[model samples]
Every structure is written in C-alpha cells, then in structure tokens.
Target chain A: MNKHKITGFQYFTVFFFLLNSFIPFLGFHKITMISNQDALFSIIIGSILMIGFTFLIKRLYFYLPNKTLFEKIKFLFPKGFFFILGILFLLSSCILLFVTQEFTSFIHFYLLPEVHQFLITLPFLLLIFYFLRKEQEVIFRTSEICFYFYILFFIISMFGILPQSNFLKIKPLFSTSISSILRSSLYFFLSFPLPLFLLLYFPKNSLKRKEGGQKTWIKSILFSGIFLFVTLFLILSSLGVQLTNLYKNPLMVTYQKISFLNILERVEATLSFSYVLLYFFPMVLLIYLLKELILYAFSLSPNYEDLVLLLLLIGNLLGNQFFSFHTNFYFSISIFLAVFLIFLSFYSFLKKE
Target chain B: MKKTKLLFIFTLLLLFTGCSSYTELNKLGIVSLLGIDYKDEEYHLYINVVEGEQDDGSLQKEYITYDATGESIDEALHFLYLKSNKKIYLSHMDVLVLSEDVINSKLQEIINYLLNHPEIRNNFELVELSSPMNILFEEKIDSKEISDLIQMNQEYMGTSFSVTFEHFLEDILIDKNSYLPLISFDKNLEINGISLLKNLKILDTLSTEETVLFNLLQNNINQAIYKNTTIVKNETNIEIKKNQITFHLKTEINKNSNKFKENLQKDLRKILIYYQDQDYDLLKLKYKMKQNHLSSLEDSNVLFPKTSLKFDIKISYTNSYLERRISK
Candidate 1:
C-alpha cells in the first residue's frame, strides 16, 4: 500500500468542498421550496445544529484514535458488523448513482444540450475510475489545488451578482410558520453537513498533524455553512421568492443575470463552471469511500483494487441508466444514511474500542 | 510502447474535437431579432439574422429578414428552419416584438415556450408592436436600431422603458400585471407609449403623457417632460394604512418648478383615480399593501378599490443657481 498522509489544510479543503458541492444544484431549491422567504433563517439554525453534531462526531473520534469507521464497527459489533456494512454499502451505492444522474442532468441542461446523456456520463465515470486507481491522498491534493480557483471565481461572480439584488424582494419576514421553518432547517441539516460523516472513512491518524483535526473539521463546517447562507440570501434577493421557486435551477438562472460593467456580459457559463469544479472532489471522495467499504466487506486485499474500481465504473453506468431518482429520494436516503452513521458512532462510543 | 503512446495521442485528439455536440460556425444562422404575430389561427414569425461575407479582403456584416407562418409558434419556427440554409441560433437575439393580438391571446403559450427552450437567454428587450409586419419587413430597421431607439428614448425622453424577459416574467408571477413599451411605424418607427397588461393580456395603452406620469409614480424616471417642465429626478414611496394609501412623491425639476409641481400633483391624482375607477391596480397597490402587512382582510381585492388616497408632492428647483431665476 502507498504510505502518504494528508496535511490539516488538505483535510480542510476536502471536507469544505464535500459539504458545499450540493448547495448550488440541489440543496438551495429544496430549502427554498419548503420555507419560502424564511430559507435564510433555516440555513442559520441548520448550521448551529451541524456544528453541534460535528462535536459529537469529534467526541466519537477520541474513542478510537487511529481506527477507520469500518474497523471500529468490526471491533464493536463483531457478530453483526457485516450487516451494518451491507447497509452502508447499499447507501453509498445509491448516493453515487443519484449524484451521477444529477451531474449528468446538469451537464445536459447547462453545458451540452445537443450531446447524448450516455456520452456525457461515460467520460465522467472513466475519469473516476482513473482517479480511483491512485491512493486516496491524490484526491485531497487535487482539492487543495482546485480550491483557490474556486474561491477566485466565487468572489468574481458575487461582485457581478450583488449590485443587481433588490433587498425588497426579501420583505415580509417571519411570514412562514415556525414548524415549516424548523422542518426546512432539518432538511438543511440532513442535506449539507451530514455528508461530512463520510469522512470518518479516514481516521484521525490519516492526517500528518493529528492535534488540530477537530478544529479543522469545525472550521470547514463553518465556512461551508456561511457559503450556503450567502448563496441562499443572494438567490432570494435577486430572484424574488416567486421567481426563485419557479425555475428549476434558480442559482444558475440568477447567475445568468450577472453583468459586469456591461462589457463582460454572457460570462455566466464561465462563472458556473466553478460548480463543476466544486462537485468533482466530493464525487471522487465518495467513490473512494465506496472502494474502502467494498474491500472491508468482502475481506479483499489491496491487490484487487483495480478490478473493484472497474466493476464500480460499470455499476455506476448501469445504475444511472436504469434508475430515475428525484432530489427528494436522494434527501430521504441521506437522512437514512446519517441516522445509521449516528447509530454506529454511538455504538462505538458505548463499546469504547 | 511507441504504438501505445500513439494510440493515447489519437484518443486525446478525438476528445479535443468536442465530441457529438460540435458544429461549425458557418453552419449557424445567428438570429438577432424575432417578431411574433397571430392572425386567423396562424402564428406569423419574423427573424433578423446577422450574415457576414468577405469582400476585397475585408469582412462585411449584413442583416437579413425571413418570415414564416404556421398554426403554432414551433411550427412557424420549424418552417423558418427549413427555409434557411443554416441552423437557427437564438442565444444572441436582442429584441422580441409581439403584436397586440399576440399579447392578447398567445402570451401564456409564448412564455411557456420561451421558458422551456434551452437556447433562449433572458437579456433580450421585449416590446409591443403596432403594424408589426410593416416594421418587421422594413429592411433598414434591424434589432440594433430597435434596441437603440428604445434605449435612447428611455434615457432622453422617459416616454418608454426597456423591459427584459426576466423582469416581465417576474412581474407577472408576483403581481399578475406588467407593461411593455409600445413601438409603432408612423412615417418611421417611433415609441408611442406603453401597453398595460393584466393576467397576461393587454388591457389598455397609456398615452405618452400618461406614460410619463406612470414612470413618475413608479420612480422609474431619469428625465421626462411633464407640462413642459423637465423632470430630472423622482423618488416615490407608497405607504398603506388601515383604510387609506398615501403617495409620497419627491421630484427635482429644471424650470417652471412651481407651476409644474401643481400640474403634476393634479395630473397624478387624476390618473390614480382613473386607474382606481377602472379597478386596475396600476401601481401594484395590492402587492404593496400585502408586502407591508397592512391588509387585514383575507380577500384584499375587495379593499383595493375602496381605499382612500392621499398625496404629498415635493418639488425642488435644480436649474436655479444662486437662488435666482436666470430667465423670467
């Protein structure tokens, strides 16, 4: 096995992009639909709850300092560990398929309207397979390099979009019911930071400096939460509640309105390409997570890595073709996965492995 | 190893060619303007395409117009596509004109088509056309000329306003009402006024003078002439109470400030009452009341026409330097 560990900053970038990749495409639309004008408040409350849950995960990490989540499960429930692994394996596969479908649909709608869907999906799957052939450290390093470009384009797009926003569009605050806001907050909690639980596949000792891993985790969650909050606020203000709810991709439509100095018009595609960059890291990481899950379940050695990756590539292609999943389906599965992971963490804590 | 390297290079070259969606620029008919008209169960479509050619080692640009008619907009576009040698491209279209009939009967269908079409952008200027075929077929007048006319008039006279597809849709969705600038060809193409719309249908056309007043009430004026007095700035605010709505209009004028202020206040009141009598919430008073949380009635439509009106008009003299009149 390749022996390479990641730095605290690499871990930070990986978790940051992982938590934020879904906001522009899926999270913002669902949250806005549920809470209407009160989506901003939902994001805020959701961030607080996410931070609290991160603390619980941080506490669980102390019980087994250098053990991956799979190892801990094996140690805690030796008899029923395979059953738990089976559930995780199914959940990860489902998420992988859903994300692949969404990415393909986004590419079809925005970038390549005339291209066939399978052609669009084939290249991405091959890319994932190519990347999976390497050690997991490559994914983190890739995120570190892409993070700077992501920030630069993000700031430029914000400058283009901020001036055109009308604050009056967000008027009549507190119009939605308290229950609706809380329910939307729960959706936000489940959709955004809950995916960070997947990072437990990399144990604490995977970092070169293990002293401040928790601090890094909290920082990434905060940064991602603030990013989501600002995006929702801008979308609501620029495209009022009615228009925001009308379009399927409100953020991209809002990006269509970005005009800088009237000379830099029609740069929406260039700006929105940053979303593709943000989405790539999480996708690669999820594939890596699935690879680890399969190896642990089947008790296979590292020699079978290439074969496993090839099988996964074919599986993703077939899954995307045969299944038509909606955003709500993905959200429901995410909630289920988060609950299962939470139960696993508590079981490990009780057993104190 | 050499053969493997060559195969990899060939595969990379294939990827660089843009795969299945690739098309040559010469094969596209770039549309810069589109016009729609409905008559006798047929939809008429007019398009202006930008064509370029090389003449004596220099490229020259030309604007061409094509017309087609069918039972539906898509069918009309399909026929146009068949007529043209190149594929129709609409991403760069600048202006879309609709006749009064199209605005009256086919707006919802048009909106659904525009929203569903992927190649259409929302930045194009929208206008209502009078004698659309006459103006559309005028070879000398292209999209640039039409866009420039509306923009220049908006900046200089304030008799017209430029409405984009995005804002038009938003207004309809939020308030169920909107307006489009009216363009007509009388001797030449001229922006006459604005056409008022309610629930996706044209209700009436406001005269140039009434359009200036409407712009004033909505605080969308840069410079306009009201009663021969030049208005340079306008700041309007609407406040809603239990049983009344108040308009706080602050204006800056260049000349004849006092007389212009009185005339403007009188005309403003007359126009408000006129619209109120017509039961047309021209100023979006119903939306404003709901936005301000001032409407207690479950059905706010009943309260809109019955509410009392109040006006506070403030005028400041901008052209008078040193507090002394230069003329008069």
Candidate 2:
C-alpha cells in the first residue's frame, strides 16, 4: 500500500479546495431559490448542517482508522455484500461526474459560448489526468498553492463589488414560507460538501494526531462559512432575487458590476478567469478520488488506477452529452447517497460496540 | 526529462490559446452611444460612434452615425451592425437614448434586448429624447460628451437624478415602475424633466419645475439650490420675495425656525396637491408603507390619485447661524 501522509496545513488546504468546489455554480443558485430575504438565513442553516456532517464523518474516521468508508462498508456488511457497496460507490462517483458535467456545460455556454462542449472539457480532464498520475501529496501541495490565489481574487472581486450592494433589495426577514426555506436548505445540503464524503478516503497515518481531522473540518467550516455567507449576501444585495435568476452565473454578473473609473470595462472576463484557478485543483481531486474508489471497488492493482483514470476522463467528456442537470434527479441521487453513507456509518459503529 | 519539457511546453501553449472568436480592434465598430426610435410601425437603431484617426501625426476625432430599421430593436441593432464598417461593440456604450414614441410604447422590448445582450453594460445612463435618431448625427457633440453633460446636469443642477440601466431594472423589479430623466435637443441638448414609467409604458412626463419638486419630495437633493421666498414657523411668518432658495443655507433665526419649517411644509404640501390629480406618487411613499408592513397600502394595491396620502416633512436643521447670533 502507498502512504499518502499530509501535514495539518496541507489537509486544511485540501479541505478548502473541496468546500469551494461546490460554490462556483451550485451553492449560489440554491440559496437564491429560497428567496432573496431568506438566502442569508438559509446560508446559516446550511453551514450548520454541513458542519454537523463533517463532524459525523470525523467521528466515523475515528471509529475505523487508516480505512476508507468503502473498506468500513465491507467490514460492516455480510460476505459478498461488497459488490453492492461497489455499486453504491460507483453511483456516488457518477454524482461527482454529473457535477463536473454541470461545471463544464456552464463554462461552455456562459464563458465560451462559441466553443464546443468537448473542447471546453478537454483541458479540465487532461489536468485531472495529470494530477491522477502524481502522488496524492502533489494534489495537496497544488491546493495549498491555489488557496492563496483564491483568497487574493476573492478580496479583489469583493472590493470591486462592495459599493454596488443595496441592502434595501433584501426584503424583510421571513418573507418566504418555512417549507420553502427548509427545501432550499435541503438542496444546499445535497449540493455542497455534505456529499463530499465520497472523497473521505484520507489514510489514518496521514494525520499528525488523532484529532487532526476534526480540527481541519472545523477550520474549513469557519473559513468557508464566512466566505459563502458574504458571497450570498453580496449577490442578493447587488442583483436582487429576480435579476439574480435572470443571469445563469450571478458571480460573473456581480463581477460585471465592478466599474473601476467606469472606463476599464469587461473586468468580469479577467476576474472570472480566476475562478479556473479556484476550481482546477478541486476538479483534479474529484477525479483522483473517483479513480481510487473504482480501483478499490474492483480490487484491482494500483498500476491499473491509470486505466480507471482514463475511463473516467472519457466518461466526463461524454457525460453531459448523455445526461443533463435536473434539480429533482440531482437532489434524489444526493439524498439517497447521503442516507446510505450515514446508515453504513451507523451500522459499523453499532457492530463494533 | 525531454518528455517532461515537451509536456510542459504543450500545457503552456494551451493556456495562452484562449477559445474566443478573435476580432482585431480595427475591425470592431465601437458604439459609444446607442439610440432607439419607433416610428412608422418600425424600430430604428442609431449607432453613434466617434471615429478617430491618426492623420499627419495628430489624433483627429470625427463623429459618425449609422441608422438601421427593423421590426424590433434587437433586429434593428443587428441590421445596423450589418451596415457598419466593423462589428458593433456595445461594451463601451455609455448612454442609451430612446425616442419619446419608443419609450411610450416599446420600452419593455428595448429593456429586454438591453438586459439580454451580454455585451451591453448595466451602468449606462438612460435618457429619452423627443428626436432620438436625430441626436445621433447632431454634429460636434459626441456620445461621451453628451453622457458627461447629462451626468453633470443631474449632479449639480438637481433638476432630476440620472438613472443607470441597473438602477432602472432594479426599480422596475422592486416598485413595478420607475422614472428616467428626459432630455430635449432644440439648438443644444438640455434635460427637460423626468418620465414616470409604469411597467415600461410612459405614465406621464414631468416638466423641469415638477421634476425639481419631485426631487425635493424624494429628499434626493444632492446639491441643488431651491430658492423660494416664504417662512411660516409655528409662531412667526416671514415671506421674502426671493425665487432661489437653497436648502443647505443657514436661516439666521432660532425663534423663527419653526416658522421656516411651516413655510417649507406649506410649499411641499402645495406641490403635492398640484400633483395629486395626476395620481403619480413621485415620493414612493406607498413603497415605504409596504416596507413598514402598514396594511393600509397593500402590496398589490396601486396608489390612486385620491388616496389622501399625507406628507410629514421632518426638517432636521443644525442651526449654527442662530447659535452664533444668540452668543453675540
């Protein structure tokens, strides 16, 4: 077995990489679905729910050290049930593939309307392939380096859009029904890092201490909590609810609102290019996790991981052609996977006790 | 090592090779101001551009206007692009001018086209002209100059506030209505007043005097000097025969401050009464009422002319002039 030990800093950096991957498109739209007034409230509730899931995943890690969730599933389930576990893992990977497809389609239509979808996704798949070839530490290092660029661009774009926010646009609190707010929270839970347990394959030896994983989890929640809340607030205040829905990518629209002296225009193109910086490592990491999970599921040799990587790359390239993003389909798949993982974790703990 | 270098070079090349249909700057016809007019059952688009050239080692700017007619504003813009020297770029467009006819009838169509166009910016100021197409080729005054004139006119003169396309969209979305500053060009261009819009149709056009009162009623007086000769506080009344009254000016009477407040209230009420018959609430008081959750003005209810709305002007005056007089 290969050792994939990473220090606390690298772990936290990769955690942020995971957290921000959901942000570029999914998280922004989900909050707006709740309504403009309730977007802020939904974000707080969503953060708490995600944090609780992270803590649960951390507790699971403690229950079975140095083991992936799939390995725990095999131990908890009866003999020959590993095949069922493998199918579940494959379905989870498909969800991640669906996300990459959505991201690819967004870039294809919104960013490069003239470019073909295949051409737009090619570079992303290639980058992921390269990362898959490298050691897991390489991804952690890349994420650490990319984190600086993310924060810098975040600050720059926030400053540019600071003055454009009209707080009056956010309607009074509780304007939306409780059911709608809860539904938005559920959509948020399914879309964001709550479902990121698919990639919770960190080796126990990688942690410097027993509690290192939980610390990273808390730090990521704190950092990403502030980041998401501020971003949602800025979007709601700047575009309002109706106009926010009017644009497919409200972040780019928010970037377009930035007028430096009102002459240096089209800053959205330059600023939003930085989103590639934020998303590239996370994209590669998702693909890498998928590769590892597939190899482990089929009980293949580590050398055959490259073959899985190629297959997944080809899968992503053709994924959007075959499948389209439906909110109901995505929400159902996410809820099923989330419940399955939770049940597996609970069963494992009871069996051990 | 050789393979690594080759891969690195290939990746670097891919990064620089952006996927865009590249067009040279010279091949692009940059639209500085866009004018839309509806006449004869057709939409007309006027592209106002400042075509500058480096002739004899000096920069020379020439104003050129292009006109295209179509069934709709979008089609008309495409037609205008087809007849242009280069591909029309609307990113640099700072001003949008609509004919009164176009605004009165086709405002929604124009707004939808502008919003849907990823190229057209939201910060561009919108103004309605009586002759929108003629202003395109009006000579000497380029688009940038006209935009600056309107912006300055709003900032200092205080007749009407400049409404950006973004703010106009926001106002429409929030209040279900909005207002745009109106400009008229006879010999020279001047801001005539503001046009009140109720869901893209022009409800009414307020004249310059009415716009001034509108600005005062809204309390958006950035720095406009309003001159009126009357003072009616609680105890005293002084009526001066002056036409220009600046609100920021210090009235030198602690005792007569109430009287001044009364006079200002009386004048504001008089202006409100004058506009009451029009059924247009320029102050957006109903919106305020909705915000406070007052059930009198329901969210679905449109304020009528006979709603009997009252204006309680809270005059906050830090009277240093009166304080100094008392010290003396």
> Which candidate should be chosen as best, given DockQ against the real structure?
1
Q: Return the clash pairs for model 2, or none.
A: B226-B245, B227-B244, B227-B245, B232-B259, B233-B258, B233-B259
User: What shift in Å separates residue A59 of candidate 2 from its native position after superposition?
Assistant: 4.7
Query: After superposition, which runs of candidate 2 have C-alpha atoms over 4 Å from their true positions?
Result: A1-4, A55-59, A78-97, A105-114, A166-171, A177-180, A193-195, A239-242, A259-266, B1-16, B54-58, B138-141, B225-267, B270-281, B293-328
Q: Which tens-of-lDDT digit does each residue in B25-69 have in candidate 2?
A: 767777888888888999988877766655565657675788889
lDDT of 1 by residue, B203-260 (tens): 8888888989888888888888877888888898877886798889888888755577
Please tell me which predicted candidate would have the highest TM-score against the true structure. Answer: 1
Residues A1-353, candidate 2: write the lDDT tens digits: 44545667777777766666556636576667565568777767877888788655665666677776667666777585667666765665666566677677666655665566676777667766766687877777777787787788889888888788888766556766788887777667675543366356665665566434776777876687778788878887888776776666778789878877777656777787666755575567667667777787778998797788889888777775776665566667767767766776666668882
Off by over 4 Å in 1: A1-4, A211-213, B1-19, B54-58, B138-140, B240-242, B254-259, B296-302, B317-328
- Tens digits of per-residue lDDT, candidate 1, A161-224, equal 8999998988767777899899888888876533566777777777785543678878987898
How much is the lDDT of residue A213 in candidate 2?
Answer: 71
